[model samples]
Target: MRNPLSDTIVNIPPSGIRKFFDVVSEMKGAISLGVGEPDFDTPWHIREEGIYSLEKGRTFYTSNSGLKELRQEICHYLKRRQRLEYDPNTEVMVTVGGSEAIDIALRAMLNPGDEVLIPQPSYVSYVPCTVLAGGTPVIIELEEKDEFRLTPEKLLEKITPKTKVLILPFPNNPTGAIMNRTDLEAIAKVIEEKDLFVLSDEIYSELTYSGKHVSIAEISGMRDRTVLINGFSKAYAMTGWRLGYAAAPALILKQMLKIHQFAIMCAPTTSQYAAVDALRNGDEDIARMKKAYDERRRYLLREFRALGMDCFEPYGAFYMFPCIKRFGMTSDEFANRLLQEEKLALVPGTAFGNCGEGYLRVSYAYSLEDLQKAIERIKRFVARLDGEKKC
Candidate 1:
């Protein structure tokens, strides 16, 4: 007997983030700050719309491009929030989630051996999707000193003849960093200079605290070259709903639609109907959730500092990437011991990339009660480690 799996997948290890998540899942009484999803329900109105659609027997498969009304809503949301315009009919395609949109976009754009510039530590899917699509993932390690943002100088240094696209993951994951307009414009200058296409993942755009979210597509000359990937996951708390959309140049969108047409057929019809409600009537929910996350963000930053971990105050997203290098333990070892000793689960920095090595990503998506418990647990864990060191 012989193994029949493809070498590309067989050689690759499982997702580092998921490895701990699987361990945590089977444990009793474990509070998970490990996942990047919100704890809220998808608002009453959004739920009602899905229910209403089902009641009306609107369960048939929708057009491959998704519901027209939902796309229009997405168009309005993008323009109203980030000042990016897209013709909903030709330039947009609704995918199962931002994850699927990411996959399809890479497949539609990159030829074999094409290189895509990705900034770390980013969402985990970009590098894997690039490889699966036969493209090379050229990771640019974002610096902690620069608030973990991808600077133009760093980007420019990474590009070569094979660089086909750049994947912009901000407001970023794990690091909870955001790029303001000035930061975006500086990179926009390089994008124009290089004539590179971009996959801008702005799923956490609504979760920014310090400044307004600026889309690269809003910059001049970028609208045509940038493929905007956003969805109802983060801001609307619709993660399990599996609803996300992509906006791109008509030609690029058409090609992506073909992939979606074949691979997914269409996004879930009920979710599409519910997403319209989320777009039209979920602003208050977004505001409420953002407020809670902001409060948690501030509290966690204060706690991390008090606990002796050097933390960069996150301005966006619901995670805090605090440097635990002072503890003199590798991120993975610390994370595992913390879980075993104190029953707390956190993603190790190296899960995101090598640049993430000395830190730990702590998600603030739990309730204040849960967060407080986690903090106490972590404090005791650190104290135990300190006592052991002194001994």
Candidate 2:
């Protein structure tokens, strides 16, 4: 049989986080802090709306652009929360999730060999999606000393004549680093000078603990240049609902909808109804969940530091990335050893990028009881390593 995979298919690596997660599954009493998902179930109101849709037999496909009402709600939500405006009819498109929105946007915008500036220690999907869309990913390292932020200087250095898009993964995954208005304005200046487009993943926008979330689209000229990507997954505990949407320039959204029309037809009709409710009636639920996560986030950061791992205080999201260099083991080695010896699972930071070396990403989405247990076990594991002088 001839090998059937395309060149693009053959080149992509599997998700690095899944490796430890899979191994941890078979272990007894394994405490996992590796999941990048909210611990809460979708709120009753949201779930009730989805069930109501089903009872009404509204399972038919929506337009490829999704329910107009949902898009309008998204526009309101964005404007109210982030102060970024978009015309719901022309500028917004509902997607299966932020993942599909990302894939479709990249496909619609890029041609073969166009360079995409991606910051390292970001979510894993961006690079692969760029490649699949026939774009080249140029990675810029975001250092811990800089609070894992992508600087304008670093972004400027990576841009070339071929550069087509910049992926800004903020309120960042794995690292939980966020950009304030000052940081964003600096980045906007560079993008304006370079005439670059932006794919801003703001899925964690509502999860910030230290400050209010600021969207790059809020900047004067950047609104038209930025594609705002967000989802019900993180903020509303709707990960399993698989609902997301994008706010983009009308022209780009039109192109993206064409691709979406051919490939996906529409996002789930039932989920769309639920998402409308989520966007409109779910603020209390969001606030409640954010409070719980903030508590857990603080606890885990303290636990990790007390265990002698040097870590950055995450400002948003539910993860902590702590440098593991003192243990003298690569992230992969340390992660594997922790899983095997302590039966605790966390994602190695290297899974995000090479710049993520010497760190491990621990998610605090688990309950306080579970997190406390995992921390104690991890502390003992580290102490044993010291006793054996194995670090």
TM-score of each: 0.98, 0.98
In candidate 2, where is summed lDDT lowest over 10 consecutive residues?
Answer: 19-28
Error of 2 at 27 (Å): 1.6
lDDT of each: 0.91, 0.92
Model 1: lDDT of residue 178: 94
Badly placed stretches (over 4 Å) of model 1 are none
Which runs of model 2 end up more than 4 angstroms from their true locations? none
- Write model 1 residue lDDT over 157-201, tens digit each, in one string: 999999999999999998999998889899998988888999999
